[model samples]
Target: MSVRDLLVLGSASAVPTKARNHNGYLLRWDGHGLLFDPGEGTQRQMTYAGVSATDVTWICVTHFHGDHCLGVPGIVQRIARDGVEHPVDAVFPASGAAYWARLRHASAFRDTGVIRERPVSGERMPLDTGDAPFRLVARRLSHPVEAYGYRLEEPDGVTMLSGELAARGVRGPLVRRLQQDGRVTAPDGRTVTLEECGVTRPGQKVAFVMDTRLCDGVRELADGVDMLVIESTYLDEDAALAAEYGHLTAAQAARVAADAGVRHLVLTHFSERYRAEDEPRFAAEAAKAFDGEITLVHDLDRIAMPRRRTSGGGA
Candidate 1:
């Protein structure tokens, strides 16, 4: 069966607590699985999550931070170990080419998986997964390191209405002909157009924002996305610390989600200072700014993709 879900493997920032692991996420979008920021011990996490190394079609590293990209070597090695025949695309910041090279070749065994390199920089950069119709977009974020956020966007298309088609007396091969030719002659000899039987369907969009403070890129990435998975590394009380570390507070992340009209806001990458008991506080702080569905992420949690927008592009 086809699947579209975001699986949280790890959700800690900088350091891993007894409960939280490092920072790893897997977004299974249709035919492709996109692994983002595979931090320390991600291979084990994937095993625990019932995910296979062969499932990964793309690996996206937000930055070269140890807490973000340490597991790349393990994951890459595992991919080679599995001997996946398909090519896997690896996306990273262009500035961290040396860091990426070092990590990719940190320790080589038998190189078998065909891992393709795709580096991103400044403003908006596009990455193609080759399997999906949608393209992934990378936007620079305000971080101490060269960090980038990613977005998956599907192109606009038309949604056929069966009722309209029936009413137009379009059936059998004629229906396919109408779709292919844009117009078809009905039994009544009247010309029926595809537009008359279909409505404009807006594509779905998902965004991932991590390890960044309040910045224009954050807003741009989160803008009108069905789901926004962002990092909330600190509580509102430690806003200064968040700023100094180039991270977002729960409230700040929520405000960005609210301003960007995000449908669902997933706050993760928590600090070790906040225990599991303090999770409510994080959700409450974000609730103050955003009225959308707020999810305080935890390890091994799976979030399904939001339902597609209705015809006429209603959210």
Candidate 2:
């Protein structure tokens, strides 16, 4: 019954539009929360999204762009104010160390927060020891600064089949015993192995990519992810400008998603140029190329992960 997938805090690119706040997103996995980008107005956005600093176990900054990470100061202060003692795993661009230091100490409040630096060193870095809920991997992107995108892949697990156990005369404590021992002696002294009654397979995967041009790294991060959250800062009409600024337009992003075999694509970091009602159009364009589910994110909206398929994979 664990909740996962995306909870958008603010989906706008820069300044808050009437309908949007700024660049902020929360990926709730298991009992842990990951705050990405965390642009301005993130404190209130968290409140609206029902996410507290205490729920945030990991913090990742793709780059130090104002639209991407301007709210770090307030977030840090709030974490201190909330008195969360659990160390937060933080990863930002190593090149932006000075900016991170400034944000970490921006407007000093009480000194009671722990932001453990886990900055990336190269094109790729593995975040976990492979035992975590999701295996995290970072890949460098073609941003102005030392920016990177993140991917979370859930390892495959075993699925217990009740009917299979029942047909084999496994009941009650014996079922529990079989699960724990991976095999058990039936009442008639028959041996039943877990492998015959259970399915152990690969789990789901989700990726997050923001503020990057259509580069190899973007495709690499988006590869086969159940869900991909990325920036669609421009519409197709502004493709020239998007290219000039190393950003992606809605159509281009959708094309990338389709090519990457993404199950669901959540587009965000929109440029303020679009009107409030233009979200549907943007999503439609994205869907044109990527027939998979396309969600044009709004601030404080929660998206549930797609149900796992019979093949033991996910959307």
Query: What does candidate 1's lDDT look like per residue over 103-222, in tens digits?
Result: 999984997649999999878898765657688999999899989999999887888899999998999999889878999999999999998998888888899999988999999999
Off by over 4 Å in 2: 129-132, 170-192, 312-315
lDDT of 2 by residue, 1-315 (tens): 677868899988866788888888889999878899999999898887777999888889999989888988888888889999888888888888999999898885787648688878698988862344778888999977788999888877777888998889888898888878989998888899999889876577888999888899999999888888999999998999998888999999999999988888889888888887787889888878999888888788889887765444543
TM-score of 2: 0.90
Q: Candidate 2: RMSD over Cα atoms?
A: 2.3
- Looking at model 2, report the run of 10 residues with the lowest lDDT sum: 306-315
Candidate 1 residues lying further than 4 Å off, grouped into runs, are none
Error of 1 at 148 (Å): 0.4
RMSD value for candidate 1: 1.3
